[model samples]
Target: MKELQHLNKYFRKYRFKLLVGIIITMVARIFQLVMPSYVKKSIEVVEGYIGNNILKSEAKEMLLEYILIIVGAALLSGFFTFLMRQTIINVSRYIEYDLKNEVFDHYQLLSLNFYKKNRTGDLMNRISEDVNQVRLYGGPAIMYGIQTLTLFVCLVPLMFIKAPVLALYALLPLPILSVLIYQISKIIHKRSTIVQEFLSTLSTFTQESFSGISVIKAYALEPKVNAELNNLALDGKSKSMDLAKVNAWFFPLMILLIGISNIFVIYIGGKQYIDGEIASIGIIAEFILYVNMLTWPVAVVGWVTSIVQRAEASQKRINQFLQEEPNIVSTVKEETPIKGKIEFKNVTFTYEDTNITALNNISFTVNKGQTVAILGKTGSGKSTILDLIARLYDIDSGEILIDDVPIKELNLQSLRQSIGAVPQDAFLFSDTIKNNIKFGKENSTDEEIIAVAKKAVVHENIMGFNKQYETVLGERGITLSGGQKQRVSIARALLKDPQIYLFDDCLSAVDTETEEEILNQLKKESKNKTTLIVSHRVSSAKNADKIIVLENGKLIQEGTHEELNSVEGYYKELYMHQLSEKEK
Candidate 1:
């Protein structure tokens, strides 16, 4: 009931259709149950005719009337079945849309850490495959379950009317049948949970293999990957067989109970016929018809139970994801735009799963329009600082300010809008060069893309492509060189014309000459913008107005290049190491 309630929230919007379907199903079930009586009447008519109990003319008329009723009932049942099918299918599709939208909207509000700790393929599976399961089961379970109940409700009284003794004989199996279903449902619930988990793991494996195919190919691990995939498939197969075994037991048990009831009905009804206690022909035919009606509802018990249990398992996973809160929330108070002045005062942060701090008591200030360089070792908090500025996560203590206003006081969207970042690995979508450049600014014209591309020193390279601006790049811009993709990303950032620019080793992929040209262009273009660059290369950060060096999440040094070079520290060591490597 609790699981079904969760599903109802998604499906309630289509209640009208569901109600109409229920009505049609009930009408159909009436037509279906009424047919058995018509069959009985037709048999009686035949019996009377063969015995010469009625005139031949009267017998012919009675036979035709019964035949028409049987045919009409059958036709009505077919029509109602069609109506119920259409209603359920349409409602299912709409509910699928709603569930998918809700999942996506919830995902949008989730914390970045959630994505970092989760697998993309698993998330995709929940939103796509898992939601689909809920939809497939949600609509049909309600429709068919209602139909089964309605058919049983309408048939029970008719069974008594047809023959009270036979009805009592059939009712004996109902309790045991209920017990069998309850036990099977519990077993299915447990096993199906395991099945869903295995499927999520399988999705993760498939996703990782496809996304990292290059690495697999480079390392020649295809055979190992295949072996692991085979293991997953085997595990899935075993779980499925386990579920199958449960279903196998259920069907035979159900058949056994129904079969016993039918045998009793035959013995009792046959005795009534012999003793002339009841009308022989019509009563016997009605008993057979009622027994046939019982077959479907009883047989479908295992099937509907499986669908409901699987959907329940999927709902649990989806609900868990939806309940996750974003690590950073909007401050609620909307403030005007800050003046681009930035400061991090005694800020501290630690990732949830990590013992060591990623940033510790970090304090710094960059006045508006200042160009600052961040130099650090691989494990240092250079990128972490950039992420903090973007408010991807909340600070443990202290505050980050923009233009004397606490960042939390400003609207998150507005705060992020004022900033543009180009990470170390400049990611581009599977789009044309012009579209990639205009990503940050959707309204950017071709001329604007061209201008930004030139400023980023990528215009000539883009023109060299066969289709120039219109050439569709491969996924992540794989068709382009690393340097080209980086420059395109830089152009995208520049086109935004943001108040602050964060370049996190954006120039790492280009050659020295091209790097110098891009740096020169950025220096010219960023005259009035606050720029923060995280670079390992000495040439990239050599001319910054101020340089900040970090080691192990702590600031180790802060000065100009000349001042830093005179000091014996990490930056000087990094600079000398790069110089020595160049010399070698």
Candidate 2:
């Protein structure tokens, strides 16, 4: 219950529904308790008519009235029970909806670091599987369990009124029942945590295998993947079985205590009846009604205990995720309508849990409308620069600025809207080429999409498709070639008409001729926008306004291609090597 304290806001919203359900449940329980009394009354009426203690006509009328009353009570109970169930279900759905929405909203608010640190499949499980399980076992079970408790509490006093000694005897096994359930609940909580984690791991594997099915097929790793999946499935099965094994022992223990309580009631109440200390059979029948009412609440003790424990485990996992603070957060106040000028002021960044800095105290500035190219070997922090510019990561030592104002002082949405990025690995959804191109600018006209696609040298290819711009690509644009995907991504970024454009090795997948053509078009298109390109090919960087070379997390050289070609440095050696290889 303490673990679920985060749900107070949602609970408050549906308090009225819960209140109505509880009231209906109480009404149903009261009506249920009255049924046995009606039964006893009917029996009494029959006995009186037989003994001739009353006139036949009067007894017949009394019996008819009693029968009608009993039927009405039964109907009342059924109605209230139905209404309670309806209300509780409504409340459950509402809570589930709210909880799911909250989790999604939180996931969106998280930074890129969160995604890097957390698996997509695990996050999916947390938002989907974990939330649904909590709703299933947590919400309705708790509601009904509470109603059951209320029924017992209300009827217990009534039982004492009917036969005080018998009532005490009926309650004698309660302590043992509670202790057993308490211990069982602890086990359930511990086991449920392990089960939920295993489920998450299984979900991770399932999602990864499906997403990378192409890679698996290409590598001919079907048997290996299947074997791994089998292991995960077996683990999941064993955990679930263990949960069931613990759950199985609980109900029988409850039944044993309940059986003992019933026996005690029968023995003590029978003695009282024979001794003439008990009143009419109606009181005894009512006692029996109380005893029957006790069964469900006691039995539900097992179920409710399990539900509560499971919920606690789930809540802990959810809260643990929510507790994670984003590594990148704005440290300054923000104002919108920013100018597109970027500067890395002696910036350095080292990832957590790593000794090596990804980016050293590097400094560079890309003025508005300027085109800069970053030339680097693999893992030379080319993409890291773009990440810092987008504020995907914060610098450990220095700051980044846009238009002389710290980027952290600009609204995140505003800053991002001003910049458009096309990375090395282009991604697309299963949507029409037109829609994919118009992704950033939702209301972009077809002409605008065609124009950008043409600039990126992809319009001819799109028109070659059977459906042209309307053709829907497969998942992750699998139907398209790697170069086509890159072109589409470029077109998508181009359609944004942002003030700053970032091409992080965007031309790597395309042929050199196509890459040169796209770069020429980008040079023309970004005449008034700051453009930055990260490329391994010297041909791609040769025409840039300026080029920077990086090595081992440090800026080693900065110049035009001609200036770097004249120098004896890393860039010069790289160029000489590529030229020598081309000659061979």
| Best model per lDDT | 1
The sequence of per-residue lDDT tens digits that candidate 1 reaches over residues 1-584 is: 46657767656778888889889888988888778877777788788888989788998898898888888989999999899989977888888888899889989888888998888888998998788778868677777787889878888887887678878997788888888889989999889878888888999999899878989999999999999999999999999899889978877887788888878778888888888978765777687668767787877766788788888888888888988988787875665675679999998888776655888888999989889999888878899899888888888887899888887887888888888889888788888888888888999888888999998898898888899999999877888999998999999999999999999989888998899999999998788899999998989999898899988888889989999999898888889998898889
My TM-score estimates for the predictions, one after another, are: 0.94, 0.93
Q: lDDT of each prediction vs. the true structure?
A: 0.85, 0.84
The residue ranges of model 1 lying beyond 4 angstroms of the native Cα positions read: 333-335, 431-435, 466-470, 562-584
Model 2 vs. true fold: TM: 0.93
- Residue 223 in candidate 2 has what lDDT? 100
lDDT of 1: 0.85
Model 2 — which ten-residue stretch has the worst lDDT? 326-335
Tell me the spans in candidate 2 whose CA falls farther than 4 Å from its real position.
332-334, 430-432, 466-470, 572-584
